[model samples]
Target: MSYHNKVVLVTGGGTGIGRATALLLAERGAIVAVNYSRSAAEAEETVQAIQQFGGQAIAIRADVSSNEEVVTMIKHIVKRFGTIDYLVNNASITRYIAMEDLDAVTEEAWDDLFAVNVKGMFNCARAAAPYLKAGKGAIVNVGSIAGMTGKGSSLPYAVSKAAVHGLTKSLAQALAPDVRVTGVAPGAVNTRWWAGKEEQMRALIRHLPLDRISAPEEIAALIAAVLEQPSMTGQILTIDNGQTL
Candidate 1:
């Protein structure tokens, strides 16, 4: 579909992958809604950048972990943009804990991780389902290579991402022939989440075929490509520089 007049909502659009996706989509002519939880400054900055470039955009505050908040956020977007064309469920959270430290993976931490990484996805998708269906829109959920290999920072994080992949497939089937649903599972990206683990990240990248971690913008571009494919659904594209191999 033509992005020139499409309306898009990007969760966690304040930083890293979300920010990159928001900016890129705005550049392509879409009216971007940048959603943020606590990163208000960053989200505002992103909106300003898009505006400066003569693109339509706005900053929305919401906690994806809460269904009520997500519902309100989607309604606000619809009120502002008339209708929705795309939803990018890119908000996620993870803790840097060694897999060996079983005690560190507390029940609370697991719940928190799933709440944002998995439930947050379902929340926004459920809220925006009607609008998306009306517009024959698309959704791109940001998953993780850790979900496929069970090799992320913690067991909870990996489990949550695995849930995201399953949700993508399930939603594709459930919302079929109307709103397309897909996912992107990325390996390590050089984002804020990778902070304080530079040595480990470099070590991991050395074994990858690409020998470099993905940039947030690179991942965003791929997400957009996935959304652009009208006939594709129920597929989780992997962009991990062959790290899984």
Candidate 2:
């Protein structure tokens, strides 16, 4: 279907991969709701950029981990846009604790990670399911290569994304023939997500098959491509520069 005037919600659409996805989808004629948890300014910037490009967009501040907040956000979106055509669960969090550092991987840390990475996706999906089904829309979750390899910034993060992968499939099955659910597991990309790991990120880039980390736009394009496919559901596509290979 043509993206013209289609309504899409992108969680964590303030910066990084989420921001890129929001912009690209808006540019392609989709009316986007850019959701942000703490990056309100960044979300506003994204909305401005979309509007400047002659696309329809709005910046929404909502914590996906909160069911009440997610429900409210959905109500507002439907109130404003009339209906939702797509849902992109791009909100997530991670800890930089080394895998061997079990001491640092506290219960609180695990809780925080799963609350955002896994539960947040669930909250959003549950809230948006009806609207999506009404429009015969789809959901594209943002997962991580760590989920598949059981390797990432921390053990908890990897576990959370693995849950996301599982959730994607289960959700596809539950909401099937109506609102399709899928995901993309992207490896390291140069975004603000790597706050203090600049040197490490650079070092790792040399070892990637592509000789460079994936760009946010590149991943966003893949997300858009996935949304364009009608027969895909319950699948998680990887864009890791062959890092897992």
Candidate 3:
């Protein structure tokens, strides 16, 4: 669908893929609602950047893990924009513990990762379902290659992402015909999430077939393509610079 004048809600839109997607969509005439739970400053900066470019945008604060907050956020966006046309579930959290470090993978870590990564996506999709259905909009959930390879910064993180992939397919089937649901699984991008792990990232790049890491803008472009493709749904597209290979 054309992004012109569309209203899109992008969770965790302050930075990384979310920020890139929001900016790209706004450039295409989408009115973007940039949602952030903790990165208020970054969200505002994104909004400001959009406005400077003559695009309409707003920075909203909501913890996607909270169903109530997600519901409230959807209502607010609908009230302000008069309708909702698209939703991007991109908010996620991960612990940097080693996969083999079972002791480090505390109950709290699992709970925290799942709460924001998996359940958070669900909350956003569930709360926005009515409007999305009404508008015949689409939903794109950000997943990770870790879900497929079963390796990432932490075991809980990988599992949570796997749950996200599952949720994406289920929502695609459930929403059907009206709102298409899809997912993008990106391997590694240069985001704040990789801060302090530069050495690890460099080593990973050497192992990748492409010998490079993906940029947030590249993933954003893929997300836009997925949303625009009328014939696609219930698919998880991977853009990992051949990390899985």
Candidate 4:
């Protein structure tokens, strides 16, 4: 995709899939706005790496769940890059616990997950809607296969991602002819979420038709393709290696 001079905002761009998406856009000549909540150092690293590769990038710290912060982030991006051409809502949170262990899934856990996963996306979208409309931009939400089928993480996480799917469709309908919105639901990505328990991870992979988990870059490739496909909108592209099937 020709991203020359395009302004792309990626939430949670400090690491994992968000970082990968930012880098991919930057490599394609997009002006990447790397958004982070608390990972200042990591976000800086992502920006620096893009700079090293002769790509334009800037790191902005904002709690995406906060309307004021999201507004500020969009303002900063517009001030720097003119207008937003793409938005990658990749910021999310999760806490794994059994249904019987209600204590493990505290009210705080639910609040935190929803705040970042669902509310954060909403805030960013709300703030960026105007600029996106002006620029005819696209939104690519990072959902999870868990949202489509069963509980891949905690109940809160699954619910939040399902909301993301709904948000993607609704936004697509609302912003049609001006802006496009879609979701990319990945399954069993090899990120920090599965740091330890290699045995369990391996066992989980064995059941997959592809017999492996997805890499962050693999997901980034999908984001790049979606950005290029102008006719496609409101679609949830599932990248689960046929696991869900």
The C-alpha lDDT values of all candidates are 0.93, 0.94, 0.93, 0.90
Higher-ranked by lDDT: 1 or 4: 1
Q: What would the per-residue lDDT of candidate 4 be over residues 1-245, giving only the tens digit for each residue? A: 68999999999999999999999989989999999988899999999999999999999999987889999889988988788988999998888877456578888988888888988998998889998999888999999998988576677788888999998999899889898898999998888878877787899998999988999999999999998888999999999888898
- The worst-scoring run of ten residues by lDDT in candidate 1 lies at 193-202
List ranges where model 3 is wrong by over 4 Å.
none
TM-score of 4: 0.97
Estimate the TM-score of every prediction.
0.98, 0.98, 0.98, 0.97
In the range 205-224, model 2's lDDT, one tens digit per residue, is 99999889988999999999
Worst 10 residues of 2 by lDDT: 188-197
Q: What is the alpha-carbon lDDT for the whole of candidate 1?
A: 0.93
TM-score for candidate 3, please give it. Answer: 0.98
Report the alpha-carbon TM-score of model 2 versus the true structure: 0.98
The residue ranges of model 4 lying beyond 4 angstroms of the native Cα positions read: none
lDDT of 1 by residue, 212-241 (tens): 889999999999999999779999999999
Q: Which ten residues in a row have the lowest lDDT in candidate 4?
A: 96-105
